[model samples]
Each structure stands twice: as C-alpha cells, then as structure tokens.
Target chain A: MSIRNKYEEELTTVFNKLIAMCRTVEIAIEKSVNSLVHRDTELAGEVIKEDKNVDNLEHEIEQDCLKILLMEHPVASDFRDVSAALKMITDLERIADQAADISEITFQFGEESFIKEPFHIKEMAKLATGMVKDSVQSYINRDLELARSLDRRDDGVDNLFGKIKGELVELIKKDGRNADQAILFMMIAKYIERIADHAVNIGEWVEYAITGYHKIG
Target chain B: MKDKKQTVKDNLDIFDFTSDIAVNIKSLNLYYGNFQALKEVSMELKKNEITAMIGPSGCGKSTLLKTLNRMNDLVDGCRIEGSITIGEKDIYAKDIDLSALRKNVGMVFQKPNPFPMSVYDNVAFAPRTFGIRKKAELDEIVETSLKRASIWDELKDRLNKSALGLSGGQQQRLCIARSLAAQPKILLMDEPTSALDPISTGKIEELMSELVKDLTIVIVTHNMQQATRIADRTAFFYLGELVEFADTQTLFTCPADKRTENYITGRFG
Candidate 1:
C-alpha cells in the first residue's frame, strides 16, 4: 500500500507458488488413479515418490504466507488471501497424502485384475480430481461461483463412494477368497472420497479469500 | 449545526459508540480556507484504549488528530464545524481554558522536538508552566513521568544531560515524558515512531500498551502494521473522509468499504 513494488511482487510469487502446488497435487491425483486402473506398479511408485515434493511445497507456501504476514502485515483482501492460502495449503497437503495412499494400495494390487470391475471407484476418483482442479481454479481466479458450486460436486463423490462400499460388501460376501482385494478397493474408494472432502475444504478457503466469509453461501 | 446533529443521529449505528467514550466526534467538518481537509467525520474513541488513524499522506488523519486538542487553531484560515466533546465538554465552547485544555490533552509530534535543555528540565517544563517550581516537586513529577514513558532506567544517570544530545528514539521518549509530566488525561501522537529504528519502535509500541491503562492514546500513523500491532481500534481515512472504523483485527483482515480495502491492500490510485 506504500507503493512498494517489491512487496507486491513477493505477494504475487506466493500466490503463483500456491497455484503451482495445486497443479502438482492434481497431477499426483491423476497419476495415482491411472497406476491403479492400468495396474502399473512403476507409475504407482512414482506417485509415492512425488509426495515428498508436495510436502515440501506445502512447507514452502506456509513459510511464504508467514513471511508476508510478519514482514508486510497485509490488510483487507491481501490479509484474507494470505490467511486463506495458509489454511488451503493444509487441506491440499492432506489431499496429496490421500493420493499417495491410493498409490500405495495400487502397489498392493500388483499386476492383478480387480475381483470386480472398479467402474464406480474410477468414477469417484475422476469426480474427486475434477473437484480438486476446479477448487484450485476458483482460488487462483477468485471465482466465487466456481467455489460455491464445488459442494454439489462433492455430493456426487459421496454418492459414488456409497455405491462403491455396497458393491465391495457384495463382492466380499459372495466369495471368502476375494476379501483382501475387496477391502483394498473399499479403502481406495474412501481415500478418493477424502480427497473430495479436502477439495471442498479448499473451496471454502477460496470463498473466504475472496469474500472474507467461510460459509459456502 | 442542528442538521449535523440530525445526521449523526441518523447514522448512530455506523458511529457505534460504546458506553465509555472519551472523545465523541460528531459529523465534524474542517477546512483550511478554501480547501476542505476533513469531511463529515464522526467516531467515538473509547476510554483508556489506543486508537490508530491510518491513511495515505494528506488524508486528513493528522487533521482530525489535531482537532482533538485544538492544535489546528494555530493555523491561519483553519475552521471547524460540528462538535468534538471530551467527556461532555465541547472543546470549542466559549470560556474554555486553552492552557488547561492543553494540559488535559498532551501531544507528541513526528520529530523528536525536545526543548534545548537538560533531560530533567524537558520533562519538567510543562509542569513548571502550570506553576510548579519547587525542585522536590519537579523532581518527583519528572521521575514518574520518565518512568511511565519507559526511559527512566536508561536515562536515570543522565538526568541532567542535554536532551538534544540523546538518540532520536530517546529524544522522542523524552518528549513523551514531557507530555506525561503534565498528567494529561489523553495523549495524542502524530507518527511518534516514524523516525525511529525497529528496535526503538518496538520499545515505544510496548510502552503504548502500558500507557493505555492510564491514558487514552490516539495515534496517526502511515504504518498499517504499527496500527495493527498497538491499536485496539483502527480508523481509515481517505481524501479527507473517514472510510472505515472497526476493531483493529477486523479492519485489517476484512474492511467493509472497498476504498478501505483498496488503500490497505496497496491497490489505491
């Protein structure tokens, strides 16, 4: 606000870095799901290895937010943006961990076909990834409409998770030998659902950044 | 005047007066000849609280601050309308004692403007003007004032030393001590630490938190961080208008007015 060019530029860098971290998590989500669907243990390993970078990015953005908070003492929308990013980064970091967890399950599948078709789980993962991407988009663009609309998409993930859980139960009941794989499938579905929940958290933070209110409406 | 009172009544919610208001400014408008410097400003400064006024240069924050103690009366062609009452007493009312008014409302300027005298004398100067000449009495007042300003231990051995010889931060504290010596009920500071280094600024800011227990402080500052750090409440002024006034945290995190948001976020033109 003092017409200081460097302060403005540093704030922009923090914002851009947060977006980059979001992009990294989105990529991780896609790769982790792909490794499972295609039964590629190598791709699954890559997703697990990439999680370290995601963790580091979360730390980096957090430090940057704190730097701006302490050095610049941002006010109003600038203050909101910094603090919202602080909270959003935590949610994003959790989402990254969920993606890694999914890849870890994919590694356990180990070149074997699913006991049953994983169509609903795949649909759930796809919907969750879409929510993550759109939430990040809303944050970077300060798109209120996009941020508010994310809650409805979360319901879609929830529905798919419910259906996946029921189908997994049916698979486990029909044959005792398929129990282990069926439980893994259920866990993967839960992780995807958790990712969607984290995306909704990011959406709430985006709304807070733009309007200074956490309530979705 | 009647219409101005009506306007203030109409916007009572916006003014948001608490029960213990020390200074109640009601739709005050100030001008310097043809140029308006403060326009229809109304706000209540709570008792025993530190309130910070912040805005860009020439935003009339200092203008409103000067009005608190009638410091602007010295400027030629300056005129004020409406009311600013300190504890139910209209500051501009006839038969008001200017010297007594100043004694009750002390001030510290941006630059360290200590008198060219010993540190003890600088602190005692104000009390002396009001007819306290005994050495023992002056010593007691000077010591207490310096202690309250948080410069006593540092300057205890240097009491008789020339105040002008001290550091800028010390000189500023010496000025604050001088104001305190008069036992003023309110202290008005205009960029009191703008000339000091960060460590010195921290000291004065710390001192402010302690001082507010006994004296209401109104500070005008260009530093938004300083406002957030020391002030309980913050008021943002823009082009001679009061844009927003709220608790310091709320004002900095989510100011209601777009103009306040723009100015605080550095997007102002």
Candidate 2:
C-alpha cells in the first residue's frame, strides 16, 4: 500500500461523516417546519430526538480532525481541509440545535392554529435548508463560485425574515389578543433566519478552505 | 597573497551595504556534466529571515543551498550559470575571493563536525586564523559565539574538554557556534538536524530561530515539519524546477501549484 493510504482513508471517513451530518440537519429543518405546518406533534418530537444523532456525528468528526492533526502533521491543502472541517462542524451543530429549538416551540403551540398562514416563514425554512446542503456540497467539491453564490441566497432569506417580522407586528397591533401567537411565530421566523446565517458561515469557511480568504473578521 | 588579502577585505566591507535582501539569484541554472540539476531558479532571500528549500531526494534543494556558498565549486564536474548577488557584490565575479565569500556565508553540514580540538579552541579557530592573537579578544569571541548558539550555559565549564566527547546535540550546537564565530552575513544549513534525536532537533530549530535575528538563513531540509516550524518562506522544488515559493503559511495551506500540493500532502510517489 502507498504511504498515505491510511491517511486518505481516515480523511474520507471524516468527509463521509460530514455529509451524513449535513443530511441529518437538513432533515431536521424540514421536519420541524412540516410538523408546525401540518400540526403533526409526532414529527416535531422526532426532530427533537434525532438531534442527539447530529450531536454525536459532530463529536465523531471533531475527534477525527484532531487525530489527523496530531498524527499526520498535515500540511498545505491537507492542513486547510482539516482546520476548515473543524470550523464547519461547529456551524452544523448550531444548525441542528436551532432545528430542535423550532421543534420545541412547535410543542408550545399545542393544537392551536398559527396566528398566520406561516407562508413567508415556511419559505424561509426551505431556503435556509437548501443553503445548508449546498454549503456542505461546496466544501466537499471545493467550489468557489457555488460558495460565493450562497451569500446572495442568504440575502433572500433575510428579506423574507424582515417581511415576516413586519407582518407579525401588524397582526399584534390589529388585536391585543393576537400578541401571544404573534410572538411565537416571530420566534420561529427568527430561528429560521439564524439557520440561514449559519449556512452562510459554512460557505465562508469553504472559501477559506479553498482560497484562505474569509469574508469577515 | 597580500593583494588577495586586500581584495578579501574589500569584499568584506561591501557587506555593510544596507538592503532588505541578503541574497538574490537571477535565472540560476546549475549542471553536473551533462545532467541539469537546477533550471531557471530565481529567488530573493530576505535579510534576517529563514527560507527553507524542500523537495524529494535529488530534486536540487541541497544543490541550491550549496550554490549560496559556492560549495559546489569543490565538485569536479559541477558548472553553474547566472548571477548570484550577495548584498551588492556578485559572488561569481572573477575578482571575488572564495575565502572571503565562504567567511561571509557560513555553512553547517547534515552531521555535527566539530574539530578534534577543545570547545574553546573550536569556537576560537576562525578568529585566530583571521589574525587575532590576544587571548582576551579570543576569550570574548569564544564566549559570545557559544552564547549566541545557545549552548554556552551547558558547555561553559567544559571549555577545555575535547568537542568529540560531547553529545550529538551539543556537538551540533558547537558547530553552530563555530560558524557564528566567523560572523557570517548568511548561514546555509543542509539538513542540520536530520542525524540528531528529536530533542536535539528541537534545540537546533530553536537556535535557528534565534540566530535569524542577526543572519539570513537558507536551509535545505527533507523534514517538512521542520521547514514549516522555523522558515518564514519556503520553496518547493521538483525535478530541477521550482514548483512553488510562498509564505510558509500559504504554501502549506493552499499552494498555487498542484504539484506542490501533492508533494506537501504526501500524495505524490
């Protein structure tokens, strides 16, 4: 066998675990939103439960990265790949946590209808989950252009979030009794917005891995 | 012979020419008979910084290091082309004195090669040869050079003892002190720690970092980790060609050339 065969195998394992974690987080985002839209408390419970699996994947990937650093003494692109993986996993874990947060809020609603149709909020969820998946793909492929394009899509998600917040304020103004439900919807919209922001963070890290240039300080 | 001494003195005075660059090689190509060892290699080594040359065996990293001090002149079939300027003087010029050039550019080999003399005499050898007879001056020079090499504290009491009796690490540091005794403007190291244990390697690396405060260092090392640890800039050579040269951080993290990436990451055969 070649000298780097074992190293390459270990690197491949870390990459595969990252893909699996991305998929799990993407599913959690989708299910949490679906549970609210369809009033399926069972689906919300599953998202919250599956969060442990996402956390475990993050821990495993972290260990793999640390081992590569300690043993291989990796340099050049290998060094960047491992360091970037360390940063990207944190964003992924935060995304999973936020998904679980949304599900917990869904449990708060408890058989009552959303104050609004959740139209703009659901749009935000779809866009945010797509950002998460595509950002991980950009990292895997080392695709600079795709990583850059996610910034614009994040702007789209932000605009939808602003629109939802304004709508919630207007609903609360229309009737004082709408305040409680409007507040819950606002929190859900905020979590989806934060998820999109985390996705953008992942994209920026991909840029660092490929070009060593982070978008912000 | 007196004329030669005056010329060497003149060459030594030129080292005072202030410049950020200590050595500049333009379009350098070296050959050993019919075999081309280095092709069109051009690099500027900054003063007071360590630049590391790394590549697979026989890729011309050591050949390039030897060219810095013209040590290749000892090789029977070796021939070189292009200009290598140290400070403002072209070292290959006919009037250039080889002894003065060697004094201005000191070298340490892969293995420790302290003289069979005592530690004090080993550090004092160069100064005495250059015509310092006073014991007081030689004493100061020996003490200063040993301290600069960071081995003075351990060997201070053992000054009268033969250098060959020291441990491998101490012997390497003594060799370094011997080089510093000559007060060279540049130091060329060829795998200076490859033969030593890890602790000794670490000591030599620490010495290099400290020594760079006063001298420009160009080191040829096969150990990539050593290059990354002590070198500010690194050059990657492959098959007589310079594949890439950049800041050590950039070269290791995101090399511009695929060849460099593959080589540094150990993906190459």
Candidate 3:
C-alpha cells in the first residue's frame, strides 16, 4: 500500500475523471464529424446535447484538483499533475465546444447535396479525432515522446484544412451557386482544424505533467 | 495598465539577488555514542534568508539544527566532526567560546519555554545575564526585542505579568523576543510552530518572514507547507543524509532528485 493512501486515491479519481472527460470529448468530435458526413441531424443533436456531460465532468475534475490542493497541499510531481489536469481540462472543454459548434452548423445544411465530396475535410476529421485520442493516451500513460509528437501530427490536419479551403474556393469559382454550401463546408473544416489545435494544447499540458517543461509561454 | 505592469516589475525587483553566506557547514558528521545522527551534511545558509530543513522524524534534521549552536554538546557521549564556520571562526575550535557562540546563534525549541518570570524580565534575562544592569538599558532592550518579535503592543500593558500567564502563542512570541534580546546573528528554530494553532502558526510564520530581513534563520519543520510558504531555500534530509538542497520554489514544484520528489509528494515510505 502507498504511504498516503487517501491522497493517492483522490489523485487517481481526478485522473480517471480527466480521462473520462477526454473520452467524451473524442466521441463528440467523432459524432459531430459523422453527422456532417452522413447529414444525420439526430447524431448532431446528440453531440450538442451530450456536451453538458463533458462540462459537468470538467467541473467535477476541477473541484477534485482543488480539493487535493486545499487538503493535501500536494507538491513536486503531484503538484504538477494537478496543475496540468486543470490546464488540460480547459482545452478539452474547448474541444467539446468546437465539436458542438460544428454540430450547430450541421443544422444549416438540411438535406442539401454537397457542392463537393468533402474528401479532405473527412481526412482532417479523422486526423483531428486521432490526435485527441493520442493526447488522452499520452496523458494516461504519461508518455512524453507521444505528447511531443502531437505538435508535428497537427501539421497534417492544418495541411488538410488548407487543401479543403483551396478546393472549396476553386469549386465556387466554377459555380457561383455553390458559394453557400462551400462556405458551410469551409466553416466545418475550420472547426476540425481548431479541434486538432486544442488536442495539441492538451498534448503540451501532458508534456508539462510528465516533464515540467511547457512548450508555450 | 502601463503603470500597473511597471509597479509589478518594480515589486519583483525587490528580491535580493546577492547571497551572503552566514553559516557554512562543511562535511559535518554527528554521532551519539556509537550511533550516527548526521552523515556528512554540508550546506551554506544565506544571510538574511530563511532556510528550512524538512524530513521525517528521526532523519537528523533536529540534530543538524542543534549543531548550529552546539546545543548537542549538552548530550551525553555526543561527538561531532567537520567544520561549522560562522564568518571566519570555526565554532568547534578548542579556544571557541560556547557562550558567545550561543549568543550569536540563538535557538527556539519545539515547546515555548518562557522562564517563569515576568514578561519584561523574560525578554531582559539574556541581556541582564550578559551584564546590562542599568534599568534604562534593560528597558530599551526589552522593548526593542518585543517589537522585533511583533508582540510589543499586546504585552506592553502587561509587561510585569508572569510569562506563564500568556497564551501559548504569546508565550512562543515571548520566547522569540527573549532570543532576540541576545542580538543573535543567526536564529535556529526546531519545529517552532508544530505545537501551536493555525492562527498562531500563521503569526509566527509572518514574524519569521519579517525577521529574515535583518537576521538569518534556519528552521527545522515537519510541516512541508510551512517550508513551502515561508522558506527561501529548503534542505531535505533522510536517514541522517542530506538528500537535496534547493530554492523553495524549485524544490516544491519540481525537485531534481527522485527521493526529494517522493518525500515532498508524500510517496516516501
């Protein structure tokens, strides 16, 4: 048994809650993108509705971190763990919000045919959701190497976003009537790119939790 | 907004960057008869800064604190090696004066032990023993010491009252005032606030912060939070060995040594 059994238990509970919150966020990104690809209003609505769960989980994890700080006054790696959890949750919550934002955009394209195939946008969603999953995995395993790799992986998502934007612009140039749907697709791609950025932020925080070196100021 | 940023920058500049060594302990080893208490401990405490020693019980933190003033010399069969120098003088030298050494390095114990005399007399006892017989001189020393300990306003009206009549917190402050009366260059405290309530502990912590501007302080504490809150630097001791010494912020946030990290994070067995 550990020396500080109760403190260890409380910290474990907070970590588990953070992992659960990350899972919910990853699912939101997946379902929101799926709703856009399949035009399923029900799944998009479900993504929007379930965001409340992610917010509540974020709140609970935040309170747990505060309780550990107030009661145990954790230091060293435990202090870093709590601090990183607090920071990572903000990015996770933002990712959930962006997922919901994409879902809200899904309501605008009601049964309309796509101006283009949205191939690069789908690829960007896949990469963004994968980054979120890998960020959470890095946190769960305290893998510094995996966390550091996320920044490079985000380049793939950004490139895909650029490709999708260029494709939409060229499609609108060919047919001016495609502007409205092309603009909505552009918005969706931008949201996916933002989701990947939030995932990268989570990865930076994970790196901080493991090694105490934050890449950003 | 520009003024606010400049004000913050000015406030941050108040930290003293020049470190003057007050006590330099070099390869110090202590033993009680055949049993070793401290093992080759070496550290330099900065002048006018609070350095806290933290470890589990029986880790020789208190033994090291006692060595600063040669208080361990009173123990039976206690032996020490290595040099502890305050400025240019080696404290363990054969011709060293124990009285002057003690006067230079005053100590406060875990329990507040105010001699059962009047509060005024308690503060004046050290000076009076050192031959300050004049009433005016004794009165001035007593008042300045009390004010330095931050307890003058409360005890000024009751100076003639017995030290035993004060509250636990007040008595501890009186004990500190008594130590200050000696005009010590370095003050050593062994678990000074472990016996007091939180409010009293806070007052003492504040007093230590205020006092460090004029005098150096070395405190041995079991309370890690106290070290984090008030110490400029902290030393972690374990099993009679000096494990790690670092600035308080780095030590508590991200200690370089794994043992130091485990100990601070409560993962040590």
lDDT agreement with native, every candidate: 0.89, 0.91, 0.89
Q: Residue A44 in model 3: shift from native, Å?
A: 1.5
lDDT for position B104 in model 1: 79
Q: Residue by residue across B1-269, what tens digits does model 1's lDDT show? A: 54654443333212222348889999999999999999999999998999999999999999999999899999999999999988667889986667767877899999999999999989999777766666888899999999999999999999999999999999999999999998887899999999999999999999999999988999999988899899999999999999999999899888999989888888787
Residue A2 lDDT (model 3): 54
Q: Which is the winner by TM-score between candidate 1 and candidate 2? A: 2
> Candidate 3 — which residues are off by over 4 angstroms?
B1-19
Q: lDDT, candidate 2, residue B253?
A: 84
Q: Which candidate leads the pack in DockQ?
A: 2
Which 10-residue window in model 2 chain B sums to the lowest lDDT? B5-14
Clashing pairs in 3: none
CAPRI-style quality class for the chain A–B interface of candidate 2: medium
Candidate 2: the clashing residue pairs are A76-B252
Query: What's the TM-score of chain B for every model shown?
Result: 0.92, 0.95, 0.92
TM-score of chain B of 3: 0.92
Better of 2 and 3 by TM-score: 2
After superposition on all CA atoms, how large is the RMSD of candidate 3?
7.9
